[model samples]
Target: MIPDATLAALFAAAVAARENAHAPYSRFHVGAAVLSESGAIHAGCNVEVASFPEGWCAETTAIGKLVSAGEKSIRAVVVVAEGDRLTTPCGGCRQRLAEFAAPDTPVHVGGPDGIRRVFTVGELLPASFELEEQP
Candidate 1:
């Protein structure tokens, strides 16, 4: 579990980022934030494109921010969306997250009210594909 302060910060950042989502087509805005191992928080909002499947998810964008900053590990993640169900990361985003997140990394899904559910990445994506570590 992440520290209370960190969790709060992540949620706040994700909420703030939702305002910038470029979803003219779907109009389903989403935002996500990741807490890096170095204590930095990276936030991203979903960007949509005219071409279907070309758009990227909020989680992927957040991971992009973390990677762009030279961070290789994610400590925790928070996803916020306006919907009846909790805004969990998609399968592709889950796999992308798994690349940098440990099995125990916390994944929080939130609705308009607040966080509705939380799960470890491993729990969400059981038996994730992992390459053998090379020495």
Candidate 2:
């Protein structure tokens, strides 16, 4: 289980990032934060473009920042959005996260109110593709 303080910090960062998301096309702003093994938190928001598929997910952006900072291991993750339902990472993000996060790494999903659900990397993608598993 993630510590209360760490969870709070992640949530705050995700929410703040969501507020700055550039989603003029979809108007569906989303933010994500990842806690690295070294205890550093990285946050990023979704960016939408007119080209649709070219835009990246919030988790992808956060992971990019984490990797750019030289952190390769993820301890936990938090995602926040402005809807009543929970907003978890997409399939591609699940794979991206699995690249750096262990199977047991916790992924917290939150709405405007607060966290609503928690899932592990394995739970989200039981058969996540791994390069090492390839023939």
Candidate 3:
């Protein structure tokens, strides 16, 4: 389990990033923050373009930043969005996260008020596809 303080910090980062989301079409702003194995936190907001299906999810952006920074593993993640129900990562984002985060990695879902739910990567993506490492 992630420490309370660490979770709080991730939540705050995610919330702050959410403010910059560009979702003029869907109007569904979302933010995601990832805690890398190096103890660095990276945050990103959803970016939607005029062309449908060309936009990227918050998790995708966060993962991209993590990889660009030379981080290969994720310790934890938090996603924040405002809605009646908790907004967890979509299917594609879940797969994207699983590429870097272990099955036991914590994935927290939050709303405007506060965190609403916490799930493991395995829980969200059971039987996920994994590539075999080459020696």
Candidate 4:
């Protein structure tokens, strides 16, 4: 579990990022924030393209920022979306996050009403597919 203050900050960042989302098609703006191992917070908003399936999720964008900043590990992550209901990361984003976050990393979901739920990466994606050396 992460500190309450840190989690609050993550949630705030995600909410703020959602304002910049370019989701004209779906009109479902989403934002995500990643807390790196070094305690740096990175944020991103969803970007939608005219071509379906070419859109980028907020979580993926935030993870990209984390990697661009030279961080290889994520300690925690939060996602926020429009409306009163919380929004969790999609399956693809969950898998992408697994690449940099431990299975026990905290994943917070929130909405305008604030954090609605929290779960570990493993809980969100049980038995995640991972590559291992097969000697």
RMSD of each: 1.1, 1.8, 0.8, 1.6
- The global C-alpha lDDT for each of the candidates, from Candidate 1 onward, is 0.92, 0.94, 0.93, 0.91
Worst 10 residues of 4 by lDDT: 80-89
Q: Write the per-residue lDDT of candidate 4 for residues 1-135, one digit (tens) a residue.
A: 778999889988998999999999999999999999899999999999999889999999999999999999999999999887658899999999889999999998888668888889999888788999599
What is the per-residue lDDT of model 2 for residues 42-111, given as tens digits with 9 covering 90 to 100? Answer: 9999999999879999999999999999989999999999878878899999999999999999999998
Model 2 bad stretches (over 4 Å): 133-135
* Regions of model 3 farther than 4 Å from truth: none
Give the C-alpha miss distance for residue 2 in model 2, angstroms.
2.0
How close is every model to the real structure, measured as TM-score?
0.95, 0.96, 0.97, 0.94
Write out the backbone clash pairs for model 4: none
lDDT (C-alpha) at residue 2 in model 2: 80
Mind sharing the TM-score for model 3? 0.97
Question: What lDDT score is found at residue 119 in candidate 4?
Answer: 89
Higher-lDDT candidate of 1 and 4: 1
* Regions more than 4 Å wrong, model 4: 133-135
Ordered by lDDT, highest first, the candidates read: 2, 3, 1, 4
lDDT at position 34, candidate 1: 96
